[model samples]
Target: MTVFDDLVGQAQATAVLSRAAAAGAEAVAGGRGAGMTHAWLFTGPPGSGREEAARAFAAALLCPDGGCGHCDQCHQVMIGSHPDLEAVRPQGLSYSVKQTRELILRAAGAPTQGRWRVILFEDADRATESAANALLKAIEEPPPRTVWLLCSPSPDDLMITIRSRCRVVTLATPSTEAVAHVLATRDSVPHDMARFAARASQGHISRARRLALDEGVRRRREAVLAIPPSLTGVGECVSAAERLVKTAEEEAGVATAALNETETSELRKIYGEGSSGKGLNRGLVRGGAGALKELEDRQKSRATRIKRDSLDEALLELVAYYRDVLAMQFGASVELANDDHRFELDRLAQSSTPEETLRRIDTIMRCRERLEANVNPQIAVEAMMLGLRRP
Candidate 1:
């Protein structure tokens, strides 16, 4: 197996990356080839494996045998433990200029052991304008031995200057068959469930795996699917909105609770609170308050982001349900993403006009935009539900 093995259905990308890895190996051996570049930009839609491709490329660059998948360098890159590799994943709304500058400074150093120093920045599109500017200088005149790997949804999401400075590696959405096969082989998921989840995910590999493995995810999606057929009027719409918001909050809470606690504990330890002494020294504790407060602020921002992500997932599910309805209404022979909800889709299609179904889809998309724009989730989703109600 090679480093590119896990990048499902990306044959072109895999071939390019393998060639590059061979070049890198040759460069290490005092020869030259086409694979080595100062920077690489990986662009793909969500769950299309952009970040995975970046990580694999980094591993390949660090591996002497050109990314032997079972080697120590490859394993370390997979788990993000390699000394020559720095993987950045933005946790909150946007990466800060300070963080960008720090990483740039660190990128100036030579590789400790490997032939190249690799910085893998995931969600590079989430960088604030200032952060992006800070990153620009590093890519423009990168250190001779350092490589930058930036992952974004699309090159258009980044500034033109930055995109122009990097070699582009585009990943396509995997086929349902590819995703289902991975779920069954890698995760040991049952064939039927894997196929269903793969279809429902619409080519999102991670979501397909989650849907196959997590009963909670399946239940949550079912709840969202139940909404369309139950929208009686304004009252029911409001109730449904409340239910969606509550469910999103609960899911986000479950995701962040342990992370928040671990961070808090680490802070307390650093401030001497958890030691064997007389608790935290009052003076040290007082001085550390500002740091703790900043951390909490970041955590709060993260929690908000988590809630928005959860709500967006639900909205996507709702969108699929309506799309299935539209397909049935038009007598389209295309397969349904939510075939398990065929009864509801058929009922809704028969009861509503195609125009009405399209309008509801528009409303759901608008709600998603509003949430991204920081509108109150309840208000945006409630308005959407009310729009979805039959006259």
Candidate 2:
């Protein structure tokens, strides 16, 4: 139950952070912080636990007993309530330069409750270029007690100047068997279901948990998998494309609805919009209009990000299914990601050549690239599905 225990398949990273934590403790005792870097860049593929590892590192650095899991210090860090820690996770599409400047100013302060002031920044890759430049200054001239833990999918995702100044911590993807074991033990999922989720997710821990626990998620995924076999005609392929886009939009709305409401409610309270016991200043509401407008704009941007993520996931699932088909056509011995759909997979594999399967996968990848380049989701998916049409 140590802080690092939750990070599966990251022994190398855990050891590095552990020694650094010891060094952090030594530094706090009026000695040099040997083996400790002022900044760390945590890089991993999606669901490889970049944020989790960084948080554990922060906990170890701040905890007096070296990350004793049950201590108050560790518990506070888990819930992001530690006085000396600042957790920054951007909900919008990008972290703006204005926000970066404000954050840098705040991070310049000394530690409040621990030996180090820890800034755990998730999705550091989403910062705009201007925002990254602003961040580079702080990292270049960091405060003595400040520690920056930045998370991204890859080292190349950030500016060279920013990444070179930080120690890199790379996490490997958890194996399917390892992910299944965690789901069965920690989430209490049945063994068979856990294995299926792990295999389907291709080692994405959070996605495996959701697939195991949520029927709605499984249904949505099944629909995406069904697309390849059902693309019999041009009209049907177009229809499937529309359905996928609609599904992504609905999923994003469902995911963000509660969060959106909560944020709006909190902002209203800050502006004194509700609970009027009479004689409240009418100017209060008027003055808060701009703030409310800004909140609305940010929420829209967040929804766009969520929708894009949903669509991208659907696209990846499609790719996995075709990959299985290609593997079967070539008689590869690897396990199929969509083994449960063996009947459909078999039929598709027998009907198509390996080259055709490859072309479809390439098309899906191109669609993903189009989406990343800000092309319309509907157009990109439609083009992909049309390319995948059997006849």
lDDT for model 2 comes to 0.91
User: Residue 9 lDDT in model 1?
Assistant: 95
Q: Estimate, for each residue in 1-391, the C-alpha lDDT of model 2 and write its tens digit.
A: 7899999899999999999999999999988879998999999988889999999999999999889888999999999999989999998789999999999988999998858999999999999999999999999999988999999999999999999999999999999899999999999999999999999998889999999999999999989988887888889989999999998898789888999899988877776756673322453556666777898999998888999999999998988999999899999999888899988988889989999999999999999999888899999999999998842
Count clashes in each candidate, considering only residues at least 3 apart in sequence or on different chains. 0, 0
Clash pairs, candidate 1, are none
For residue 61, give model 2's deviation from the true position in Å.
Answer: 0.6
Which stretches of model 2 miss by more than 4 angstroms? 275-286
Weakest 10 consecutive residues of candidate 1 by summed lDDT: 276-285
**Residue-wise C-alpha lDDT for candidate 1, range 1-391, written one tens digit per residue:** 8888999999999999888888887877788766678889999988899999999999999998888899999999999999999999888878899999999998899899959999999999989999999999989999877999999999999999999999999999999999999999999999999999999998999999899999988988888888887888788999999999999998789889999999988987888876755557662567777878889988988889889988998999888888999999999998799998788789889988999989989999999999988999999999999888852
Global lDDT of each candidate: 0.90, 0.91
Error of 1 at 258 (Å): 1.6
